[model samples]
Target: MAVIRVIYKEYIPSENLNSIVDTIWIATNYGKEIESRILPDGYVDIVFDLDKQKHLNSGNEIRISGMMTKFKKVISRKNSETLGIRFKTGQFNAISNIPLSKIKNTTINASDLFFKLNNSFLDELVEKKHHWEKVQIINKFLLAEINWSDLTPNKLEHSVCQSIQLNYRELDLNKIAKNHYISLRQLERRFKATIGVTMKEYHSIIRFNKVKDCIAKNPNLSLLNTAFDNGYFDHAHLSKEIKKMSGVNPSEL
Candidate 1:
């Protein structure tokens, strides 16, 4: 095991890309190469290495990581920086050429998709030093990928996903389906297609994320308080759920 010092920065996407992209980020690993834990967030990403990529991967090609269903770890490459786009939930299907179902729990070369990544532009991305400049470069590519006519999200996806997030504690698929005038089976089918994970799985991740945020913001906060606050039945319930998502109990953190 080793410690990696990375200057990781995240920026809000511009208004145009905001609907599709959750954040534009830069990760620069300058010392003590460390491994990164990538958790399931029900979203996908496109990662570009700013410096010539080496140790962490076989080639310098741009890569796309699909929605992770569980935790995955990656070793940090020494003296490298990454510029990436974390797509918003349910939006990857619109921008990516690859099917969400095919990519679950794996990463593949962007060339695996229908569109050919421009080599000339990739050269430009490597030459840039400032993160803001890299963001603009990525934004241009994403803007072209957007389907201007299809600006709206799928109705069932929007409603069901919103309901899950809105009530992270009390996720009732039956109630949600009834409320939306769709059957549970229909919503499950749509959820699996629109997003890679099942509705129950996605809800669990969302709830765990909420608990993580709560703890991250208030380190001194008690586990019992954290559990109750995030709609868990009790500390024991929170512990079990956290372990499922992160492979560790809340006390460990």
Candidate 2:
């Protein structure tokens, strides 16, 4: 098999920015174009195509990708450099008034959301020689946008989101609603508004990620054991879920 030559890196934010920003990441491929699958993780991102020769489908170098609800395939252009800022779940609302529901499973030009930044901003990023320099510029720009925005995370909605993420394996929606003193319907509505996916869908994404990680770390482990350990009913159930989310069976995953 031929090896794929790609340079990918991620920079996690400091404690002060951790709650809002998940990480800044970059990927480059200088050879033939490559393809990769992106699984949903219920987060929003701002992606910049650093190669002036290429652009997003919108014909812009900068774009905002909304919360993903399913798997999608993306291509890395030949001699491409792409950088993105992934926002934490439900936190992109703090930066822009654009509703998460409006952009679900879609990519739009960044200018539509970041009206505060000038059109020359993309060019400024391209002019930076080092990736770290580009990251610093983005960090400063986002901090300014966050400080000027008055919107705050919804209290109860944020709490429920946290609960689902932390206890994805044993999620009990009714119990969560009762503990938060809200009806199940109300909880579902709020979660959909904040996260751009249903509570169950987000839970599936979190659980699927955990399952994928478990398999990666312990490839020798049996499917039955993995299923039971991760709270799935059985091997068949786990296989079904993995297939549904990733378009591949557990063994293939």
Over the stretch 165-228, how does candidate 1's per-residue lDDT look in tens digits? 9999887889998998988898898887787778888898888888888888988988889888
Off by over 4 Å in 1: 1-4, 53-57, 118-121, 150-152, 218-222
lDDT of 2 by residue, 76-132 (tens): 878888989999888888777666877888888887768644447877887888988
- Of the candidates shown, which would achieve the greatest TM-score relative to the real structure? 2
Q: Model 2 segments beyond 4 Å from truth?
A: 1-3, 13-16, 56-58, 116-119, 147-151
- Provide the clash count, candidate 2: 0
TM-score of 2: 0.90
lDDT scores in order = 0.79, 0.82
- Candidate 1: deviation at residue 133, Å? 2.0
Provide backbone clash counts, one per model.
0, 0
